[model samples]
Target chain A: MSTTDNTESLVQLHNAGLREQGRWRVRGISLRVRAGEIVTLIGPNGSGKSTTAKLALGLLTPSEGRAERRPGLRVGYVPQALAIDAAMPMSVDRFMRLSNRLDENTLVEALESTGVANLRHEPVTALSGGQYQRVLIARAIAREPDLLVLDEPVQGVDLPGEAALYQLIADIRRERGCGVLMISHDLHVVMAATDQVVCLNGHVCCHGAPRAVAEDPAYQALYGKLSPALAVYTHHHDHEHLPDGSVRQIDNNASPGCGHDHG
Target chain B: MDDFFVRALLAAGGIALVAAPLGCFIVWRRMAYFGDTLAHSSLLGVALSLAADVPLIPAVFTVSLAVALTLVVLQRREWVSTDALLGLLSHASLAIGLVVFALLERPSAYLAEMLLGDILTVSQRDIVLIFSVALAVAVVLLLAWRPLIAMTVNHDLAEAEGQNPVLAHVLLVVMMAAVIAVAIQIVGVLLITAMLIIPAVTARRFAARPETMVLFAVGFAVLATQVGLWGSLQWDTPSGPSIVVASLAVFLVSLAVSRGRHA
Candidate 1:
């Protein structure tokens, strides 16, 4: 919401609802994504985070409400699930080309930005989980899309690498000034860099600044013992965020993060 | 070669040229059962044709397309599991078609050929229809190859990237129905899925990219047709089953080689 300007939103879900299996998977969700900002969706499993993302992507039609995107919105998506067939052999360079017919230089730059440039010729299926996730991120970044939507992008990544990836997302946002919409269960990463957070439980439970959502009771109820970690993060000013994302407070002399909220 | 052999080769060549690329998608999407369901329902088209005194190809294409649309609708509802839904429609249509055929008074001798295939006896009209469908499917694939690959990688990603994944999916199923309707004559309905999957599955082993895999699959199909035709000629066996068997044999060999090295 606190994006740089009053530019038209890249994508919007205006009271979107998708119903199936005798219930609404996601309902009455309204959101707007603008350039140069990050908006994250967080919730328990089946809270319809992915469903809402699918709606915004136009992969699924809204049953009741409307979902819309800016005309000719160029989007890049990084999915949580490794949706590509495991049996199929594909290299990172090939995967990038499959996404968009980018020139070799663009493909290399994408890989370089994601720190997987060396693995361009490596078989994507054979890459380790962490490596493959980075490869997927590279593929998404290759398109130079106006909006980047990531669903659980930290999947298959180590705890340390998770924060780095989030930081990289921040870097990408800064460099491209593209609107970013992401889904995450990790509150630490969500609290750190996101401009806004939407906590969902089959509907928008609470949404606003990360600090407000962190303090929200609905968010508290869904994610029990979440506030303490946020408090620890806030309380620790001088400590470096560890590879595991825990920080040690200077005045209080206590380890602020217990790693409970880390994804 | 004799006239019959030339006709068979032309039919097989047309099928191989178009089918191999589409088959790669069928394998990637794991829609083998869906393809089978459409192929099996072609018998319903035949039954409808016979009962109404209509043309077989048009009747079969219509019924197969109808079955595909029905599957898409049922899939949206999720009233039944996908495999269960496929099994239900597949057998139900086949049973209905058989019942319809039984009610008629003709085809005491041709029933066996119908159940399998009489590719050797295909007339010029049949070849024309086959080639036309192949050409149409090929053009659709050519225009759609990028979007199709993106959608296969991740539907939400593809949609967000402005690729229209829903349109891609609809187009895929329509093309699939057409393939089934045409291929049902070269291989029986029962063996149609075999033709769609076996070569793609085999190609995955030797090729490191999707386009290459498709080309390899085409090569495999051509080889299967050639070897099967030669074997059928030498042993006086059924042509369709021989082709299916030849392709299956190649797949099994690839699987063995892949496992032996990797294991």
Candidate 2:
């Protein structure tokens, strides 16, 4: 594995081997998350991406390898299945306060940053799916974690909402410089938002610049024809969107207005 | 009120105070039957107490904790589906307790006392034990309130955020068992689950935050307890079943009120 340039790589997964159904399932995967970089993992369903995230967080012990987390390194994560009871009432402020030692101003700022400050007093269950995800992201950022990981963050959200969330994430990452590792099946958004790409098909197929990895023969072979619309995004550039509705350029691969088709 | 009425009321109060938060979490975590399973397992404690000529509270608590630990271990291992495991343990424990009770060389009339509670028979020591357990559970819950909310809302996210989900889950189950053991002598196994479920279920409709829901649950439980005790006094009815009915009534009222507000 290549060494990350940042000295404060807060999280390291060393040859992690995850087991499923009582078998040593996914093996020999390693990851290095720097203190202030966005690294996105893209993989097909059942490719063990979620398992990898769990292992990183110490939610699951590796069957054959180890997960080393820095002492006092805080992490914030959003999982694919949210495991929350919608019927059980909770407000945005209360949810945000679940973090360790968050100040009220920081909470408000996090909410404002996510464009959901108005939801502070509202029952979280009352929020739209998009609003819920945004609030969740806001709650995560309120903790000011050194590493933030999101699993399919935009799944089950509408297109406009997804865009709004992407913008919110970019703002937080730029402002806080927290390391981000997101798992996404949506190649378009993943490509648009992330700096580094890690492709997995039960193993680390490739990890490098998004454009280079997207164009790799191995990546195309694994997730190539999975969806035709996604194939359109494989050749796209990164930079997602800013909170100001501006899109920046990450690479020279695609033109600025190339996402016009999505609109 | 008369001495009998006071004793019954105090017994009801204990159940309400303890079971309200315990029930809410059980409902939230979908561990409703697990609470029932623990309550049912207290019959084994009763049998063991009779067999060994021991006091009921200590015996019940020990057995309930053991059962709770067993449930957590089995659930963690995925040895059986949660519902199936709970059901199997519930019936098995109750059956063993009943069989052992019947085969006792010197059987007493305490079997009915254990099955259908006689609140009038509750000693001062029982009251002390109940209150002590309630206080301990409340203090522990309050201290771990933030992490508990985070863990129950989203285990994976909570785990990533440096809240240990395993410990949180175990603590919660053990607390539920404690509640069950303490309340079993006053409410009985059949109705103990009601005390742990009804108020929380009702509260969800009336409140939109965890703190508010807990308040609503406790408020509803206390109300049910008072009303049920009064109704039992006037109608010469069983306290436990009367309390369950009162809780049901409160739930329906809350549902109607919440619907009316929405409308």
Best by DockQ: 2
What's the TM-score of chain B for every model shown? Answer: 0.93, 0.94
lDDT of 2 by residue, B58-166 (tens): 8888998898898778887886798898899999999998888889954355776677666677777777788898899989889888788888888777777888777
Worst 10 residues of 1 chain A by lDDT: A250-259
**Candidate 2 residue runs with Cα over 4 Å from true position:** A1-6, A22-24, A157-164, A186-188, A225-233, A236-263, B1-4, B105-109, B252-263
Q: Give one digit per residue, the lDDT tens place, for model 2 in A143-262.
A: 888888888887767888788887777667777788888898755575656766778878887766556566577777776667655565554432232222233234322222112111
Instruction: For candidate 1, please provide the TM-score of chain A on its own.
Output: 0.83
Candidate 1 lDDT tens digits, B21-140: 888988888888888788789988887898999988788889999989988889977777989999999999999988988898767555565667666776788799889999998899
Q: What is the lDDT of residue B100 in candidate 1?
A: 87
Q: For residues A12-47, could you state the per-residue lDDT of candidate 1 as single tens digits?
A: 898999988778899999887877778899887888
Residue B96, candidate 2: C-alpha displacement in angstroms: 0.5
Tell how far residue B44 is off in model 1, in angstroms. 2.4
